[model samples]
Target: MGNKQFSQAQKLTILKHAKQIGPKEAAKVAGVHYTTVYEWKRQLKELGEEAFLEHQPRRSGRGEKEITPEQESAILQVWNDNPAFGPGQVRSQLRRQGTTISIRTIRKVMEANGYTAKQKQNQVSAPERFEASRPLELAQMDILEVTINKVRVYLILLIDDFSRFILGFRLLEQTSVDEVIQLVRRAVDQYGKMEELLTDRGFVFYSWRGINRFEKYLENQGIDHTHARPHHPQTLGKVEALNKRIKNELFGQEHFSTLEQAFSALTKWVEHYNHKRPHQGLGGFLVPAERFHGQEQKALDDIANSRDVTAQIQDIERSIVNLVLAPDGSVTLYLLGQPVVIKGGSHV
Candidate 1:
């Protein structure tokens, strides 16, 4: 029962030795204790020669508390009925019905039976990574393929990295580089330009050989074009997160007779999404518009009356003395109200 278990033959041998010598002598010879020898002698005397034979025990602990088949079946039944309920929820529900079980045991049973976990991850999550600090710092573009009324169409989306604003989108029969460029341009026009435009290396957005028209357009506009890390969509985390929200909450669930109907609904939804829908990242569930521009209703009137604009203008004026062209036609520009000029040997 302890670390040592005596086989039937070993028990018989020990009993015979005990009969020949004594309990203590038999224990010393067989590397067992006198109490163990005495217990075996009592078992042999009580049951005769059949004492060494054994039958399976009716109850087993397996080093843990027993769980009845009915209780196990109840756990399986609850899990099968509500596969979506996590382990804690399942345990709580079972407790409401007066059956108490640990989440650990439920999880173990679920896993051993090849069923999905009811609960995973601890409640708290790690902080977000690679987030931008300011509005218009980085923008991302992505395209989603959707099927409506048996016809295939695409949803092109653009979102700001910081505010998570849905800058602009288009639902079209197909994606084209010109449409994508136009979308970015429209976003810049509306929200001001971003420092970089991040997108996947899809053919519509990028080409490796420097012949991509979209790349050329961005370059000409003085906007940096960056591709998301190969096969890693999290590089465009904000846009991808928005895309998943749109599909799960809108496009994937709705029914439409035509693409036009879908587009019309989406256009209205985009308006609400930009101006009304609360975003978690913004804090206070502030809408993207508030986070981006903030109280545009009478904001202009306030800015005009406020000293901030005048102070910015005075600061700019003080930072510039003059731009001068040297004899060789090279120019000197200065901030801090000074000019340092240099000249070439000759101008050809």
Candidate 2:
């Protein structure tokens, strides 16, 4: 059986042909050497038809030292019991149990044993589009539409764009100019006037005819103002972001039939947003109020001390009377100028 290759039918046919005819002619007809024909003839005579069959050779290398089915099942069982254990850890554990296997082989075993790799599902929503550079440099205001007792109501929200601070907010039955003006005055009175107030070009903001009272008041007080682009609510990104959070995270499930209930809920939510919640935009994940006015207040105090108080006061007084007319019909007039009559109206 040492490299003596021949098919069983072929060996039988060759033996039959060799017995019938001469070996040389049979070998030529069988398309084999004359020595092969003689060897087949001798095998058929000594061992009969069984000599045509073959047998597997015995292995010599570390024959079948690989892991058994039981060992593979145990590895999978350990993986199922301890999901945190990866292939390498499972392999190490198997080694400790006297079952030697490479990590790559263990990985293959795990994959075959229902440990198929799958990608993680991502469902987290994306963050807002806009961002602020500095604290209190910009503020966003928005009016949210909601229903109270089946009647529509608007929630006027004034939020600081930079620090995400809810400066002032009010719920109104109507989106009237008076309501918005009151909210703006409340914010200004509480936290000194802001440098810039960013808002959307809503009817309340544009005042229907583009005669924005809020903008006019801010201009009168020398505060910069801006309105968001038309139909682009994301321009006032901070307020819009806060409104969404309030609606979803805070007031999503709560059913409030009264304005007072909504106000109370908003108060609590605003407190949480200002003090408890950590803002990723702020450094160290600090609260918006803390970063917006905390250190800046101290710095402003230090600067205020060095600034000339009298000159500042005089400059403010002068600015107030910059639009006033003098008795001689002069455009530039001070508060000390005498009152005059211009077209039957008093001007001081």
Q: How high is the CA lDDT of each candidate model?
A: 0.66, 0.61
User: Candidate 1, residues 1-348: lDDT per residue as tens digits?
Assistant: 223455656787888988889776886787654545665665677677764456222332332233445666878887775454456655644553446677766765565455553346576544357765455667788998888888899999998776677889999998999999899888777657777788999999989786689999999987888888897776777787777777765777789888889999898777766764445565422456654553322323433344222112212111123354657777655322123334663322
List pairs with backbone clashes in candidate 2.
none
Instruction: Name the top TM-score candidate.
Output: 1
Q: Residue 63's C-alpha lDDT in candidate 2?
A: 26
TM values, all candidates: 0.50, 0.47
Clashing pairs in 1: 86-118, 87-118, 87-119
Which sections of candidate 1 miss by over 4 Å?
1-128, 295-348
Name the 10 consecutive residues with the lowest summed lDDT in model 2: 310-319
Give the per-residue lDDT of model 2 (tens digit) for 1-348.
122344567567777887788775886676654545554555566675664445222342322234455766877775774454567656544543445556655665665444645567796665457665444456778898877668788888987776687888887778876788788788767665666778777776776665677668778976677877788676776677778777765556578888888889888778756653445555422445554553324323433344312112112211112243436775532221122346756443
The TM-score between candidate 2 and the true structure equals: 0.47
